[model samples]
Target: MNKRKISSLLAVTCITALIVSGCGGGSGKAEDKVVSEKDYEPYSKYESPVEFTIGRNTSHTNNLPKGDSIENNMATRYVESKVNVKAKVAWETDDMDQKLSLSMTTGELPDVMLVSRTIFNQLVDNDLIEDMTEVYEKTASEGVKNIYSSYGDLLLDQVKVDGKIMGLPMTNIGNQHQLLWIRKDWLDKVGGKLPQSVDDVWNLARTFVEKDASGTGKTIGFGMNQDAMNFSPIFAAYNAFPGQWIKKDGKVVYGSVQPEMKEALADLAEHYKEGLIDKQFAVRSDEEKEALVINGQAGMLFNPWWIGYTNYKDSIKQDPKAEWVAVSAPVDENGKFKTIRQDPVGGGIVVVRKGYPHPEAIMKSINLTTDFLYSLTDDAVQYKKEHASEGLTDHSRWNNEPTQIPMQVDYDDVLKRYYDDIMKADKAGSADGIQEDRVVSYEAYQEFKQKGTAVDANTYGEYLSRIEGQREANNPNLEVIPAGFYGTTETMKLKWANLQKMEQEMMLKIIMGQASIDAFDQFVSTWKKTGGDEITQEVEEMSSR
Candidate 1:
């Protein structure tokens, strides 16, 4: 974290024991740290508020201007007070593809937008988004630079197309660690220590499902069926990553057509026949599945780090005894685990509108947004500079409030450094040891390093949560995968599209036994014929860069 020797007029000497319980504290008490009724002028309330219309998508929460939401009230008000930039949501949570495509065709855009990698590429192709590279170079702080240094190559690899990195991609603090996410109460009733190895994991699942160890007749051992996310954790150890990696010679060769997929399928099919898997996962919607977890029908589930946050603040509100801990994501029989790194620039919770009046304003907004997140949590920056990476955090990301780090950097060494430092600082009681913007970041680092193992979930709500014996996330010494080249040549695009589609469809079918693994040979033949070969050649060329 960038240390500026905080010289603000608002400085108050923070107490150690006092700040420990930042959450679950009284809101209005003098001891309460919550910013309550502070008088301030908002940026959006300018004489003619510098209108910055933004576009976004929302599923879990409404992104539009809600009367009582923090975005509308606290954060928006905060932005106005601090930056003097009037920000308003123009459009949110509709078909983004259609909106962006129309905007491109019509030459109409908001000031900033949150678009997918594909949309970002299209904007680059059409010369839409202003380049933030120079802006970041000139105005960005050292803390922000640390973020870039960690994921800079990743952004270049995925978001940067045609020699320019267009938009600033949002990032996650950490994700993809295998979390067991098991019911703690059930374990107490079952009367046994946590499992240690793959065999132990299996035995626990079997006993929970068959013996009804938790005394909750409705609950089962492992609560998953067709969920690629939850189920993949257990199988990741045997050199078989969750879905498919499509690798050749040990580098991800897209496992759909690879022979190892047959192995994974056979294992899954056996579990399905044995009744260890969830019967309703196939039909359950996202919300329904979450219900299954809350209702205690399943003792274990799989999920990313964010889900853990909801468990504490949201889900636990309903079931207070429901101590959801993160168990390790399962490892393959050979003690192997893998994660398919997501493109840092692809997925994000926030996006700038395309037609906002000022491009630099968008850059500043992004910088501030990330900085705000990092400051509160302090993950991206801390992990960027930390060394001696070990351990995991006990707290959730929302609670820690660090600047978000993209998941692609989760297992990468570049980030482990930051994580290590943040934890050391937080545990040492020097909260201000780093920048204030990194609260979440430091918390995440500390959660993993200190308390991660203290709270393991049946589902992977947090990375450090332990299952029988394993932590939800992987710490295997693996190399970071290069970001896949987006927006290739026309022939390359067509062929790559066809090849990937064919591979995905065929792989799912083969895994479900709807198609035979033998179909792979046929797939290989068609892959070459359908421009897979050309795309491969193109990818090979791109990789050389």
Candidate 2:
């Protein structure tokens, strides 16, 4: 119920996407003069402003300055001023998938939209999105192009159908694997070293609960929500990647049904039965699970590096003694911390409606925004300085842009840069070559060092996530296992929901001691009989292509 809790939940969800011949919509004239590829420029400003309607997918908190709306924020104004393109918000909603489904049913779509992978494929199949192959090549800035290329063909290839790029895929920030986050203070009090293996993690959690390290009788050893337990570090320790399509014996297979998963589930069941995990986790909301950590009722969780920027920051604010530290942990028998690599391309792709005039405008807007945000140009550098002087750090404004290929190229490398250039440099806090966008966090790190326990929550969060959390994310012993596939198959569309529901129910039941470990085998059998086999075959076929 806390405001920070809402913000943290929104932060997790905000992270996200066009048409064609055989496309679903009717052909229409260009809204502006169509320029040839030879005449195209990445930052070309149109003589007459090109206006496009956007079905904006927004976050719960825009954090805009007074009198500024999502339709006319700093990002929108910058795009219009630089590229002479006006973005009109036809409609905005936090639930883009639902809104887009309604739009598809009504046969009315905005000129542009950021859609999920499922919706993107649907739009392409319906032939309702624009082909942006030429537009991207001609109108994307060098930096934007470089960002896409950094992922090699892994990203762009996903949006390519019949060798034509149909939509722009959003590049994910790499190294988003879960890490073991534990209260260092609690571990110290409980008299245990850092956990090195699954057994060690269990012993430590048991110790924390048995000793009541939180000093509260209701202390929870491992705080987790219903679904999140599937992706916990413990599963990774057993080399089981639930919710992912993984390669096994060179065959694309569903991870949840793997033999390794049964072992992991059995371990989780044993732990749950022993009261190491939160007893009410199966029924708790995300906020309630987070409350365990934030309110000092839990000492550990498995989350990405960004947890420092979310729940733990609030925890520190409430209790300055709460010292959260991250480790790439619960190593397997081989002493390697293995984690599944998420799909590098995000869930969404940015697509323009079929027959929309000037598809190049989308690329142009993306180029301008990328250049400005990264301070790649002189004007952008000056703008960055001005914005910093104005004390504006509300990054939610960037989401207001009409079209974007949101990317953080070499994201993991940023931590290396911070370490080499800032942390271990001759000049302690000099941020000479760091990207302008990250300078704020650098400043926050400096403030955190100076202010320590008295530092504000925002400053503490930046330091924790960017510095401490990232350090663990860059662990040398971490084994990164790539997902076998990221796209949804046809069978998945019809049966994945029911299959996933059944899997979730079975996993939760087993963990809660309601169902025996043998239930996993039965669930697998039912899953295969009821479309799981078909989905796996489809996944193999797609992967082969």
Candidate 2 residues 419-523, lDDT tens each? 454464325547666655567777877887777757777777777787778888878888878788987777888898999999899988998899999999999
TM-score of each: 0.65, 0.87
Scanning candidate 2 in windows of ten residues, the lowest lDDT window is: 15-24
For candidate 2, the lDDT comes to 0.74
lDDT of each: 0.48, 0.74
Q: What is the C-alpha RMSD of each candidate to the true structure, in Å?
A: 14.6, 7.7
Top-TM-score candidate index: 2
Candidate 1, residues 453-525, lDDT tens digits: the string is: 3434323233322222232343563223433333344465445666666766664555455676577578777
TM-score for predicted model 1 compared with the true structure: 0.65
What is the number of backbone collisions in each predicted candidate, taken in the order shown?
100, 15
